[model samples]
Target chain A: MAATYVSYFGFVIKSVRGMFTGGPRYYAWLSFLVLLMAAGAAAYYRQAVLGLGVTGMTDQVSWGLYIANFTFLVGVAAAAVMMVIPGYLYHDKAVKGGVLLGEMVAIGAILMCLLFVMADLGRPDRMWHMIPPFGKFNFPVSMLAWDVLVLNGYLLLNLHVPGYLLYKRYRGEEPAKWLYLPFVYISIVWAISIHTVTAFLYTGLAGRPFWNAAILAPRFIASAFCAGPAFIVLVLEIVRGWTRFPMGDRLITFLRQVVLIAGLINIFLLISEIFTEFYAASAHVASARYLFFGLHGHDALVPWIWTSISLNVLALLALVSRRFEQRGLVVRNLPLAMLIVAIWIEKGMGLVFPGFIPTPLGEIVEYLPSANEVVVSAGIWGLGLFVMTVLIKHAVDIETGAVAKNN
Target chain B: MSGGSRIRPGDVKRRGFLKLLTALTAGAVTAPADAEAFDLDAFLQKHFHQMSDDEKRRTLQRLEQDYNDKYERDDFTVVADGPTPGVKFAYALNLSKCIGCRRCVHACVQENNQHRGREERGDQVEYIRVLEMEKGSLDLEKAVHDYDHEVPAEDKYYMPVQCHHCNAAPCVKACPVEATWQEPDGIVVVDYNWCIGCRYCAAACPYWARKFNWIEPRLPADEINPDTHYLGNRPRYKGVMEKCTFCINRVRKGLNPACHDICPTGSRKFGNLLDKDSVIRRIIDHKRIYILKEEVGTDPSFYYFFD
Candidate 1:
């Protein structure tokens, strides 16, 4: 038992050492991420010193860019389940080889989600008050509490599965099924829960009519499946190009089918939501009005929502056409990139911002991300990418046998 | 392994990277001196309801001292008095009598030590919002809170809204840390120190009564209300949520809320709702009363009445 523990520690050390040994291009990419992260840290310092007031948030529109990014990234994290189910349940050999990379994306995305939540907090230092036993965890009651549990649990599950598998691979030994398979199955279900709970965080609010729809959870899951796999498709392509990981084109093709179906379902859910809000046009539709069009000349989000809608339609058409398959790699990947941005806008600012417009008192307060907020958000994204880049690099090296236990 | 060959520029680069990392971390850790200092006791302070009597007393004293130090005033006092026995507080406003002078808004600020800075600075926090609506319509969608005209336009009626202190307050249920809850006296109070500032409660409130301190609240020393309740109008920090506690400190001591006291037309009324003959109870029983957003089912203790 002690020998096993020591071996695991040695594996971690060697893997970390491998991450720092890449070429000049790798170093340049890492340096660029570091620069963005440093800028973000500086901007966040100003926000922390002054307050959230440094952002464009007001008492009327309390939440802004931080929460918007957090909401969108929760879906991104949950999308890892698309890979897990196919690799573990269906035993797809192509996907099975790349499951660790998918889980790495989950790790990176979850880390970003957590950072966004912290940035949104007014008393982040007092976060310990939410911990069980020490702080009053309003579990089973507050959806936010449920969100914390699910997000953290999902993070741990993603970490353990990949970590265990990578360690076993390093030893050139077969992984014991009992140690990691159960967690894989749990994660498949756990992935769905994180997004559902995040949806509940918004849906449970009775006062925000814009988010009170029963369709929210379904919409959240559908969008996660759509955007999650699309993002992984892009990452897998990068891995194939940058490393000798031998990822098959068949896996990318299979994921494109998943993205297509999930994207269709997402579009359907959105249409259903739009119809429900606009057909009858109740007073509760003020937020929807503010989002899709302008509310009393406050049209800040109108252009954004329309742009998102147009992109979704364009991407859906591109996915359906299959003409891109004959074209170059960039053209084939264009629809997926378009879908990602569309969903980002739809779920991020498109969903969170409008909920606060036409404040509960029937006042309209428009919110825009200040320069500081944008920098902080970009910094977090840079950090997530940096983490994922290192993690994937290490995992790929292990798979390629560049670093071995015997050596 | 040719260690000597590899150690030259690589070591220098690694050292440079480490130095950069260390500088970034140090920059992140070192907050401005005037920003809220890291207080160990304050950081580790227990939840307001969970603290024992002695703990509560110490916490209150610490808060008072912190406030005094921040404002450079020695007279700041914080009280942790609990709910008075057998008293269920409620409020009523005579809608017909209200003239929308906005005196209650300013008075609440003075009495509560609300931020008095410009709105652009995000420190301008006000508890009461007076809405001017068309006389014949109750549709809140058209109600204007920023009407700049003179008192009570002929075609408009005024409705002033603040924290309703609901019997089934959604904000309390929405609080992830249980930072806000309904007290024994039926007042929904927030433990400002315990709040995580996620603003979920503010979103859950249909009345839009809850407010967030986006920036460090700025109250001039001369304008600071020295007497404060721990769960009430104790000066708040930047990034916490606070709202009208129906003036928890004043009401528990048998004084009316500043909003109720400053109403120029005697439009606001407050009393112990548990009492059979209190003015609030009489108004609820005898007058035509309305609860804002009744469909939301908050079951507010606050009511609007017409004589």
Candidate 2:
């Protein structure tokens, strides 16, 4: 038993070393990522020195880019379950290979989600205030606390299951089904939970009439289901480009269907929400009005939201049409990429920022991310991509390189 | 190699040494002043309900001392005083009496030690927002928060809004760390030191009563209110959430908040809700008063009434 623990410890170190020892192209990519991270860190340091005042956030718009990114990443993190459910629960073979990669994407995305949260804090040093045994967390009451718990819990489950599977494969041992299968099922439910809790973080707020809707969680799920799988498809295409791994065309085909169905549902949900907003023309319609057309001569968001919807509709068409995919990878990937970007903007600023427009008392204050905020956001994305690169490299190594590992 | 035990001291020591290095480096950045300033006891202070009277007093004293040292002010004290027995605090505002002079806004800032230099920075922070609304139209969506040309304009009515100190405060319920909560006397106060500054409270407030310190709040040394309440206004750091505590410092001493006292027309009335004889009590008993968004079931103690 002691030997087993020692062997496991050794295996983890070896896996890390193996990950670092890659081709020159791999090292160059890492260096580029490191450079971006350094730039972001510098920008964040300035923000820390000057205070959050450096960001475009006023008391009028208390949350900005950091939270927008955090919200999107939570959905991205939750999107892993789209593959985990069909691959494990229903025992689908076509998606089985993609599930590990999906989980890997989740692992990277959740870490980014957490980093974005830390970047958003005014007193990052006081983060210990949320930890147990001291900080009196208002659980079951404060949706923020629920968010903190579920995000961390979801990250843990993803990390554990992926780490367990990879380590077992590396050691040339068949992973015991009992040891990790229960956890895989747990991850499926937990993935839904993390995004739901994130949605609740917005919906439960009584102040923001824009997010105070019953459809928010459903909207979050539908968008996430589409956005998450869309993101994975993009990653899979990139990975297949870089390696000779036997990725079937059927996998991409399967995922585009998921994206099409989910994306249409998302658009449908959005239209329903818009109808409710404009139908009665209640006081709450103030935010929706600001987002869609213009409100009170302050229509800065008008062009951006319409442009977002157009891209979404365009991508939905391209995703569903066989003629579009027949245009080839570069051509097809454009719409897929647009679908991802469309969802990113829609789920992000389009959702979070409008809630503050024509402030609760009816004053119109606009928000745009300051240069420092942009730099910091870029830094977090660079870090997530860097992590994704390493995780994908390791998985590909297991599939195509020295390890003759199998499930 | 060791045949019996794989565990090794040198490996453990190397790991320990690296961890120590990281801690020292992190400590240097986070705690630049005396290690004593980041009081472990204060940093790890337990929940208010879990603390004894002595513990509470100690915590307050440590904070008072920390502030005094940081600000170079020797005569600053933070009181931990609670409400008078059986006292339930409430407020009433007479719309007919308010003149829209904005003296109450400035007075509240002075009393509460809100960001004094915000105006100089092309910014402003105030607990009380006075709105100029067009007469006979209650569409809050069209009200203007910043109306410069007004001694209560001919066609306009003024309604100054602040924390209602509701029985069920959304801000209090929104704090993930429980850093903000309602006191027994119906005052919602923030433990600024413990707030993680997520601004969840600010978002949760329907009235937009809470304010975030975008910059480290500037209360000039000369302008600093020596008499401070721990929950009301001590100097705040950048990022923590703060709101009107109904001028809790003065109210605890049977005094009116600065805003109440400064109102020239005597529009604001505040006192114990349980006291049948208090002015606020009489206003509530006889006047046709309305609280904002009562359908939300927040049950605010503050009331607005017309003549």
Candidate 3:
């Protein structure tokens, strides 16, 4: 089945590459690159000239889309570690083919994380202060400093481990089998740590009662696994469509099982959050009320949250159903798309906005990212995809040994 | 405008040089002797003792040079010198008489060097919130101060809340940067330069006394007060946090708070807690007074006394 899958995909790729011959696809890729660079230049110019005010953020909502995207991307990045560790360290042959692809996802996700952090900083120039002594970042005390250290460490790990393996393979030297094993274990634990720490950034705030739950970090991990695996599944389908890679339906079924478990955990964690908030009858319950219904007179966030909840339920049902998971194309694709959108809305506005409602001053200030913010975000995403495209192209070339065959 | 040798000492005529020197000599010789003999160190020492004699002299010289270059007046400096030995500062408010006239608010802005911004768009000057209250209810739960309607409304009594200068301030405790600290006199002061703008202190303050400058504060140069304290408002940079210092710069200098002094009804009272005869003490003894969020055990130095 695997050999047949590879040969059939190879035939399609050869035909397409022969017809294109570095023409239309190349131009299309170039156009995307131009669009990305233009958007980045515009955003950079605006930020340099007008300061953070160009981002549509105010004192009331000091954070905007930058932070929400940061949170979401960190979760996605952490999920890559799970795939790498299980496949390589534990010798899970079923998942081994995904190990390289998982690292590639981390490379793109971490870049997004860094960009988001840069966008949110009031003095992006002062980011160098995170370096050491002169800047006095106040380690251990500030969760931000910890996030900076861990994220960079993870990026370094991904870069060196994968680059070394690829280099050895290119030289026709057999790579050390055990070289990636230890890193894989570390990566697994590190993956869970990244999302936990990201969640810690919000939950550690004692003042923001909405985020002060002990279950918050666990919930973050569960949701990250659910959305991250689902995204990987979608990427697998795209890879299958575009290239000669032999991805098996059985592997897709396994990924669905992972998603189903993650979804169940995510739903359970959210239920626990609701239970605690409603049961406690504390002032903190005010935040929950604002999120689910409305507080005082504000209702902007209610509809978006309900939609996330419904989509999550629907995705969970589809993913757990064996027939639905195995179904070709449409049925399998719908659940993955639904999970991604559900987590996006949930982690983006649903998670952040409620944490600020009934604000410290008892004001309900609604937040909406401006047009510039949205455009800049889109540009960042395009840049990530551009990087991903180059990476996948390189990986496929190495794996196939014939650039033309892969193309 | 030249390639090196165009302008030289020979470019100026000898006659012009001599005339210029003569004018300088005349100006120097005939200048006010008192101005030349100014003993600012001696005078300033009499007022501000915090500085050592050498420090005083250097400060005096720096001040003269600064003034000579640009004597842009309206350089208001609120004094922040420590009080006379046995004095312990305290404040009390007569909530019953506060008419919500905002006279105290205006006075605070001026005295504390708060930059004025647009009424609708800019940040508030001081850290005081004048919450309107109900006649029969002291219960904050029943308080109708958070009305969506515009303010200066009829049938409401105002209760102004500043940094209670809490004895157990959450803001002081939560400052990871140590930018904010409680002074011996029970006032919480922020080192504006040291603050990282993390907003942790702002979040911890239950009274919401702190305000973050999300944008650089813009004050027209003419309006910039020349007299500045480094820790108080000289001119804060963008992103740092600031709050009311209870007119620390003034009250520590043995002057009443600008807000108390300017109150039309004398609703705000400030005095030394150690002095039994202080008017603030008399108000505390004679009237019904309350500190906000008292149940939280912050032990605030500020109080609201019923007239």
Candidate 4:
């Protein structure tokens, strides 16, 4: 067992060196990526030094693109559970090694979600008030408190469950097979709960009529399943092209099916939302009107929402078509890329913009992303992606028994 | 004879005094073993059927006193036989006989102990949202109030909106926290401390009767209302919401809100909607009185009838 661990670790070290010197000039490319990250860091500093006033957010549109990204990323994190639970708990051999990557991605996405919330809060210093005893933490009553708890819990689960399995495997020690089954079941329920609660956080608000709907929780889940699987597929393609990652075709086929099912549900939910809004045409429907059809002088959100709907339909079609799903790498990437973007738009803008469309005065106002807002949002994305890249690299190494020999 | 002599009046009297002292001390320390006991769980468990006659009498007396303390006032007690089944309130608005001076706004700020803005910023904290509506557009929809422009721009009518003390308030129902509630005589009040700052009440209110303090409220000591109600304009804590309470302190004290007393245009009106002979009732019956967002079905006590 010790010899196996040592040999695996040695292989990882050689692989890292080979990529830089012996293999295709990947080291040079990595250096360029580092430079890009440095640029993102500079932008992040500007945000920290200046107050939230520097952001594109105004009193009229208190939350803007950053929150949209945060919302979208949360859905992505929830999507990882789709892979983890089915693969481990259900004993799916095709999805075994693949599930760890999803969990790693979740860890990255959750960290970004937390960071986005910190950036959103004007007084980030007072976040400690969320702690107990000294702080006034209202349990079960404040949804914000619940969000903090669940997001953190989900992230820890992703880290520990996968991390433990990978650790045991690297040691060439037989990991207890039944150990993860219970966790996998918990992850399945927890995964659905995370996204559902996030939806409830918004829809539960009786004040924001735009968000107050019974369909929202299910809509969020549908979006998560659609977007989450789509993202994983895209990442798999990228990994396959770049490195000698052992990704199975069976796993890809399985994910594509899940994406198609989720996509149909997402589209259905969108239609139902429109029906409820147009049919009722009540005072509560004003915000939805502003989002879809321009409210009194507030036509800004109409184009964005329409584009989102279009993208969603297009993505759904791509997934439903078996020809497109099982196409050549380049051809398949197109639909997968489109699906990811479509979900991002649907989750980010479609989810948040409608809530603010018709102002309390029944006036429609537009939210334009200021440069600062874009940069800050970009920085957060870069950070999450960067973290994801490192974590996935470590995971991939661990999985193929390459990182064992180095330690 | 010796035993009788030993049991003297002095010893007997001393024993009686000690007994009386012990009884008085116990009574003072524990209060009465009635409904007002420290053990609320025990008191709650004791069913009405189980309650002693003395307990029932004490409870009734306490309830009666609480009722008197909450509602009854010497100046404005409810008169069941009157035109309205409550105190008669009269509102006199003479828009034709006035100018758009914002003295009323200032009066409201000072009288209500509003948070003072920074000296450098010259901030305005007026709850009364004044709308300078254009003429010939009788519809409130075309009402364009350029707040950035000076007050009373040429050819504009000033309209102010506050908590309408609505008879059927939508805000009261929308409040998940039960922070804002309707008073017995039809006044809407917000308990600032009790509010969770979720802003649901603000969204539900047709008249926009609520305001959320996004940041901590800053007011000088002198600016604070010493006689502040927990529900009304007390110095609000951060993260809680607040709003106009119809000057609840003065309203309960048989006085009008400062804004009403200081309005130059007499455009602002107030009164008991129930009173038949009252000016508010007269305006509602005789003239076209409009409530903001009437489609929302929030029956506002604050009515606007063009002169």
Per-candidate DockQ values are 0.33, 0.32, 0.07, 0.03
Error of 3 at B21 (Å): 62
Candidate number that wins on DockQ, 1 or 4: 1
Q: Is the docking of candidate 2 incorrect, acceptable, medium or high quality?
A: acceptable
Lowest summed lDDT window (length 10), candidate 3 chain B: B3-12
Clash counts for the predictions, in order: 0, 0, 3, 10
Cα lDDT tens digits for candidate 1, A250-293: 88988888888998998999999999889999889999998998
Query: What does candidate 1 score in Cα RMSD to the true structure?
Result: 8.3
How far off is residue A366 in model 2, in Å? 0.3
TM-score of 3: 0.76
How is the predicted docking of candidate 3 categorized under the CAPRI scheme?
incorrect
Candidate 1 structure lDDT: 0.86
The lDDT per prediction is: 0.86, 0.81, 0.66, 0.62
Best by lDDT: 1
iRMS, model 1 (angstroms): 14.3
Docking class of 4: incorrect
Better of 1 and 3 by TM-score: 1
lDDT of 2: 0.81
Candidate 3 lDDT over A184-260, as tens digits, reads 66777877888888888777666567877788899899988888888877777777767776566666677777788
Q: Residue pairs in steric clash, candidate 2? A: none
After TM-score superposition, what is the CA distance of residue B265 in candidate 1 from its true location, in Å?
0.9
Badly placed stretches (over 4 Å) of model 4 are A1-50, A177-179, A405-407, B1-126, B130-261, B265-307
